[model samples]
Target: MNKWKIILDYFLKFLTALILIFLTLIIIFKFTIFNKNYIKNNLKENNYYEKVYDSIKENMENYIISSGFSENILDNIYTNKDVEIAINNYIDIIFSNKKDKIDLSKIENKINSNIDEYIKDQEIKILDKDSITSLVDDLLKIYTNEIELYNMFDNYINLFSKLQTILNIALICLLIITIILIIVLIKLKIQNLGIIPFTSSLMLLYIRFLIYNNIDYKNILIITDNFSNCLVQIVTKIVDLILICGIILGVMGLIAIILDSRKKNKKKE
Candidate 1:
């Protein structure tokens, strides 16, 4: 009977450790992937808007030159603030699962106004109205494509939202089960509850190591260098966050073991 009880205790600890591992992954996904603000904050940190503006300017320059306009026509066509607003709106559309298109009225007006001023200043009358419209449309496309790289995921936003809800429910259920297991272990005088967290922490660290080593995130090339820079920064930060969580759990596990040891020593005395 004593042997069977020991076996049961070990089984319970093993089950608890398994749950802890899943719980750790769920927490990481909740904070990093499912969290919209994580992306927003990373983009802001990496100056993503400024990079986007530079790309837009470069792309539009080709149109200006082909249309026989001075490069000055591109001046003040748009600002970094405008790009920031447009990108944020694009993100909101994806996260909110809205079908609304990004409002380019402001940008369109600015480009048109600039072009009219340039044509008047140069007194050039040969440019076709359709050509001007085509130029404006093409420039706006650049902004849309750059900001909407992840628009493909828009279809899954609803599925992701449902998955997030399920994860929250699962996490709560796991926490309740863990608490019950802790109580049972304590009553059995099993002081190895720390093993669950310790094992989980190690698993997290191993997963982080695998991702860091396997993925060449530093050299990731996406739609453009600017976009890639922001993507790399976000990925690197997520990896660092995983490492931080692993260290925290490891420390907590050590503290738990130490406290349990002290309790056993007091009982012995």
Candidate 2:
């Protein structure tokens, strides 16, 4: 090959490898991170009962300890099973349905109604609207925070929507360019097709190593237990898919090398 052709060949090979890795990543993130249906289905499958239940229980206990309610009243209120039941129902509703907007007013009203029933059952005479408001406000703090987080995620998804068209176009163009590069390599009598899958596998292995070594799940859990659990679930699914793809590509690369070797031997014979 002439100097210019040789340089062009090397550059195309490098570009092909880079595009292979990028294409794999784009596909993975597109399906897992940006796909709303996938996220919703995964959370539904996990149920999130333990994470949501424990966080709610702990935060409410802390709130009750710091509040101005009398010890006897607080003790009676905390001991009631309805608090746990209400929290579970709240979480269930939020996760089980795909709603555009979360109306805290509706949630507050339902909680107030539940509190009224609880007071009627306990025959507590001293608990007026002010006291009830204090208790409900304290309890709703966690729910409100959760709603805010949901809104943040909703905004994130919206941003993804704006970028989706651009991403799709780039993905398609990259795929076509990658295929053309591979075909050109073949026409130039360069056995470089295996490099695409080999580079893909290497990229996935690097990502897997980073995930295993760099993440601090403990700190995440400490900061926000429920959100951390959800994050872990999503990361786990992504890692699993990466591992599967890596293994498949690695195997294909090996098979291609073996076949290439066999073909060369047959020509010599």
TM-score of 1: 0.85
* Worst 10-residue lDDT window, candidate 2: 71-80
> What TM-score, over all chains together, does every model reach?
0.85, 0.68
User: What RMSD, rounded to one decimal, does every model reach?
Assistant: 2.7, 5.6
Candidate 2 clashing pairs? Answer: none
Error of 2 at 84 (Å): 15
Q: Residues 42-65, candidate 1, lDDT per residue (tens digit)?
A: 888887888888877887787667
Tens digits of per-residue lDDT for model 2 on 1-269?
A: 78998788677767786787778877987798656567656655665544455555566667767654333332333322433344444444444343444344645676666656656777777636787787787666765554344344443544555566667787899889887877788888775466667767877788777887897543455345556677788877787788887888778877777787888898899
